[model samples]
Target: MWDYSDTVKEHFFNPKNARAMDDADAIGDVGSIQCGDALRLTLKVNAESEVIEDAAFQTFGCGSAIASSSVLTEMIKGKTLDEALKVTNQDIASELDGLPPEKMHCSVMGREALQAAVANYRGEVWKDDHEEGALICKCFAVDAVMIEDTVRANNLRTVEDVTNYTKAGGGCSACHEGIEEILTRVLAETGEAFNARASRQKLHASKEKPPVPGKGMSNLERIKRIERVIEMVRPQLQRDRGDVTLVDVDGDTVFINLVGACSGCQMASLTISGIQQQMMEDLGEFVRVVPVPANHAATTGVTA
Candidate 1:
């Protein structure tokens, strides 16, 4: 189980200002129910002082999402829109003591909602959608611009880290190479070392290997070993209201489908990494875990 802070639990079980405000002066909406997370923030502003007199939110998501939204409403109350705008995602996580690295995206969502609400009040155009050319992750509607901004804001170091923060590269696995390119450029500009290939090699090296390496197993033997490793990891995910199913295996890449809560989870990247590490150790060979769409069979073929 995740080690949630006491304050996070408190706010989740007893969220404040969770009701809709019919007379709100400003409103912001983000995410979609189809995506397994959505939030609508409403604010009552004092016209003369430009202060947020009240705030409320309605969200459809996990406990962390509820806590983030609840704390955001309280934090922005009595502050001017400009003052509220300065509140970052880090601040929200701090206010709740702290959120797990996997749950940090909840805080980011809260910050975006506040920005959208302010834009609404100002009568300015605010959109989260991107053009097809700029889109990066079609599964989550995450664009390259969003990925770049998040990498800078969070100092993200890996494709997994980006998935935890922005849900990019968390599904299909086809956008991973694209995400790595963005990360490489961003990290270079910031004077950070981000050798994508080296980083991946390092991750593989960090995993424990078999005591004695065998010559190599046949394809049938390899598939069975992968299945056994996945079976070992499946119970842990199921305990958390999620599950995984093997879709197909092609050479070093093992395709799988995340079902239940795991389907759109922000922690998916970590989950995939864990599965990959285990498979490599058990099979005594390099392997990559790639999450495919649940309906992968309907598609032409899994890529990446």
Candidate 2:
């Protein structure tokens, strides 16, 4: 039972474009059952005009997810691809008068589905800029480009803010630190939005927490947590015909090496980002994981 806004409840109960469009020019579908939400979007485009004549969606998700998709379709109708591309998760949430922090990810799914459809319309390639960056959130397949874009687009200031706008850290929470780093870096780019050094200081200044047993995670406990996160995300890589092996853990940095098919795959940056994010969520916010760098894991799409 959540206190959903009137718009959210209205769209959830009577979603627009709820039916399928068999003649859609492009269809973008993303998310998974494991993540608890998925969207299938279809659009009928007027190619000569380069405009979306009609759009429809069939979503399998919570109330927010459905509502997000519903509102998304309405927003994009009669707009050119350029105009549609500008629509983001923030726009969807704003339309619904905002969502609870934890449920923000649902809106993100709507945006992804629309992006995928737009990409499909343009071509089979996933032209979304984020796919080229590190994939930070595996549960929802969130990438660094996506998170950075959301932060910049909405001026997200904190990890929780990132989650609110893009749901980057809402799922497993392993990517909380990774998202925080991105938030800091994005803010630093503006030269006034944030202080990266101060942010890092905050993450490392946890020494005040007593080292007493049961008071906080011990070194051994932390190592075990890291291992569990690896195991949890390992299957996701395997599905891509790739493999990852732990190489070393240096302070906050966990270095891993990619192998097999993924060793040379162009999508490795995304893979590395996914691994780092999951570890941060499982191990807590101070983690800074990196791949062994294929050279140095190809510099990871998300830079320091």
For this target, which candidate reaches the highest lDDT against the unseen true structure?
Answer: 1
Predictions in order: lDDT: 0.84, 0.75
Candidate 2's C-alpha runs over 4 A off are: 127-304
Model 1 over residues 199-287: C-alpha lDDT tens digits? 57755768544434434678888888889988998887876568998988876778899987677676677789878877877877777
lDDT of 2: 0.75
Candidates in order, TM-scores: namely 0.47, 0.46
